[model samples]
Every structure is written in C-alpha cells, then in structure tokens.
Target: MGAAGQPWSYIQRFPTEAGVPRTYELPVAAFQPVGMRMDPAPQAPAALDPSIITEVSVFILDKQQGPFAITITGIDAES
Candidate 1:
C-alpha cells in the first residue's frame, strides 16, 4: 500500500520461479522504505500511516526493457 503525502515508498520482494504462480503474505510492518530524506531541513516520518494509504500497486522491479503483463486477481487488507 502506498500512502498519500509520503516521502518514502514501502516494498517487499519475494522470490519467484518463471511461469509459476504463488501466493505471498507480506506483512504491513515488514514493508521497508526504499528512500529517505538526508537534508539538513526538518525530517519526515519514516513510518507509513495506514490511515492515509490511497493506493496499492504491483509491478516488476527488474530493470529490463521489454513488454510485461501482470494480472492481479484480488487484494485484501485485514486489520
């Protein structure tokens, strides 16, 4: 989940085998931030606020130039 007005993006990477479908359970707390502010100015919160989460996205992180297709069957969030 991506939160609004956040400086950092959270991510959890899972291992996969080609052409094999798998179900992954990623804990919200386990999501690590990729970027952080290092300026001398006031700092932003490192944690993500669940209340402000506006979207969730799935994509391939591999830096390759090619056409790719990913099908998301469903997304469920439990409190």
Candidate 2:
C-alpha cells in the first residue's frame, strides 16, 4: 500500500484480535545488522513490542532517494 504518496506495505499474521492498535516509528535507515553501523549517529528505531520480536523481514520500496527497505523485526510475546 501507499501512504502519503510514499510506497509502503505491511505483513499480517493469522489470529487477528481487537485491541488497542499500536504504532511504531522505525527509521528507514536503521535496518542494518548490529555490527554494521555505517553512520556515527544513531538511526531510526523500530516500534515493535520488545517482547514479540523474533525475526525481521525487509521490504524494498521504490522512491526518489532510490530503493529503501523497511525491516520488520518479530518480537517474542512471552517476555
């Protein structure tokens, strides 16, 4: 899907529920591995629940700044 003229998409797992929807703001520049810190300053962080992140999936979107990937890290809910 496209948000605010920007190309974006989302992944939804099974067993949906009706609870307070949460929003996390992850910078498009901070999806690198822990050892790969290109910039001296910190990059954008993800908004996923700390207890539910197990794996991360990256998606690339076409933009003027070239293609950018948004990584969605899965967290463990049993924290």
Candidate 3:
C-alpha cells in the first residue's frame, strides 16, 4: 500500500566556488496518480541559473510501484 503523507522533496547540491550543481530525486509517494488526493506537490529549487546547468537527466522506475530519479550536471560559479 502507498504511504499516507505526500511524497518528500529531494534536493542535493554540489557546492563549487563559481556555482554549485544540484540534483533532485522525487519518489512515487510524492504524487497521487488520479482520483485521489495528493498532499503537497514536491517543490524544486526556486530560481536556478541556466548557465550553470550543463546537463539534466530524469529516470523513472516502475516495478512494484513508481520511483523517479533526477540528475543535474553543471559547473558551479566557484569552479
């Protein structure tokens, strides 16, 4: 069975002198498919400088349930 609470927001930061790269992973528990009440939607970072972002990838795993993984590649200002 699914969890009760809404999915949690995942955030990771790669600190750099110039600018830090960041990645976020949101689990399936975060959202309700449909015909169901979804707690609070996961929130991503506010405004992120596009220049620092070199690449971004999103992956979804559907086995017993649903799981999502997101990876972001960038160069921090410090670098």
Candidate 4:
C-alpha cells in the first residue's frame, strides 16, 4: 500500500472495529515510543491496546516507492 508523502513518524497505533482496521499517522517524532513522552508533545499519552488489536505494523509513513528493503525477526514457523 502507498500514501501521499507523509512525514516520517514513529510508533503508530491502531484500533480494530468489527474485525476491520483503522490506520493513521502519528504526529510524534520518528524516535519516540508510543507510551513515552513525545517531542512537541501530543495532547494525550499513548499505549498499546491488545484487546482490539488484530494487526500491528511498523513502517515508515512515506510514499511506497519501489526498491524497499525490510527485515523482520523472531519467527517460529515450526511451532
């Protein structure tokens, strides 16, 4: 999926609605954790919500230009 040139951010959290997902860009810096203090400060603090979390994605909020490189670990396919 692609988006229109949004500035880089960190720790974007989402909520699920009836098995559907809602997505948005966090206004915080690209280095701040969701639950910790953010630069320029958000009105409300952030935290992880596990109940309605169906999927969580860690990605750069930039245009999905080609030739992207990503690496993920902590897998147990044999289980």
Candidate 5:
C-alpha cells in the first residue's frame, strides 16, 4: 500500500473481472485521500501527486482458497 517508500496517500477501489484481461484508466482526480474526514461537511478530494506515485498495485479480494494470478500489462501517466 506504500508508494515510493511513503505511507499510502491515496486509494481507489473498483470491481474487476476474475479471469478476463482488460485495461483500466484511472484519472488523477479519482483517487481519494487515505485518512479520516476532518471536515464534518462533505468536500471534494484533493488531486493526487503523480510524482510521488513510484509504484502501482492491483489487489484481488476474492477469498477463494487457491493460487491466484494477476497480470498488469502497463502503467502510464497521461495528462
């Protein structure tokens, strides 16, 4: 969960296919900050700092007891 040796700063969870392979595009603004909401009122999340994102991870939450495989074809930073 750490990025570039720094504590997890942002995260986003989404559903994905079990076996089928596909690509996912994540915009910079889509990731929410990781922490308690200090503000009592709702507010928009801050933009993610792409420079600090030195790594990318894909975690499978399926609880089936067996070996699992996940293939990440590529990771790109787009404007």
Candidate 6:
C-alpha cells in the first residue's frame, strides 16, 4: 500500500547544503512467487547524507485490523 500524502516535501525543510532538489523513496520488500523457497537477492541501500538528515517520520494512512510498527535502526557507532 503506497501513501497518498505529500510526505516527500518534508525533505525540503532540512539543510541540504546543495541547491538541487532531492527525493526520498522507501524500498518495499520483495514478494516471492509460489513454490519458491530460495531467498530473494539483497538490495543496495539508499545513499543518504547523514549530516543533512536531522529527523525522520512515518505515517500509517489507512485503517488496519491489527497494530503496525515501523522500526529504524543500524546506525554507526562513530556517529
């Protein structure tokens, strides 16, 4: 399910340093075909500039029968 809001515009509020516009696209997990047992290939992560990212946000736009969660992790210790 894709979002309907203009969440991408939020990136404009950050300190990009660069004058050009930018976009942030979330990667959706892959779905396997029937009778397939092997795991799908891994994907390269988005190249993000840490110094420009000050905050993040998530939104659940539609109604759901059960609770949902979004977890953000895996930051470098040196940061």
Q: Identify the runs in model 6 with alpha carbons over 4 angstroms from their true place.
A: 1-54, 74-79
TM-scores for candidates 1 onward, in order? 0.68, 0.21, 0.21, 0.27, 0.62, 0.25
lDDT per residue (tens digit) for residues 1-79 in model 2: 1123212222332221235344454543333222122232223232223333444444332234743333335533332
Our tally of clashes for model 1 stands at 0
Show where candidate 3 strays beyond 4 Å.
1-45, 61-79
lDDT of 1: 0.64
| Better candidate by TM-score, 2 or 4 | 4
Query: How many Å off is the CA of 55 in candidate 3?
Result: 1.5
Q: In what order do the candidates fall by lDDT, top score first?
A: 1, 5, 4, 3, 2, 6
| Local distance difference test, each candidate | 0.64, 0.32, 0.33, 0.36, 0.61, 0.32
Report, for all candidates in order, the number of backbone clashes: 0, 9, 10, 0, 0, 0
Top candidate (lDDT): 1
Candidate maximizing TM-score: 1
Clashing pairs in 2: 51-76, 52-75, 52-76, 53-74, 53-75, 53-76, 54-74, 54-75, 55-74
Candidate 1 ranges beyond 4 A from true positions = 36-44, 64-67
lDDT of 4 by residue, 1-79 (tens): 1112322223544432344433444432333333223243243234323332333355544555756554445422121
**Lowest lDDT block of 10, candidate 2:** 1-10
lDDT of 3 at 14: 26
Residues 1-79 of candidate 1 have per-residue lDDT tens digits of 5667666566667766667777788877776665543232224355556677787866577777866666668777778
TM-score of 5: 0.62
Report the C-alpha displacement of residue 72, candidate 3, in angstroms: 17
lDDT of 5 at 38: 24
Candidate 4 runs further than 4 Å off: 1-47, 64-66, 75-79
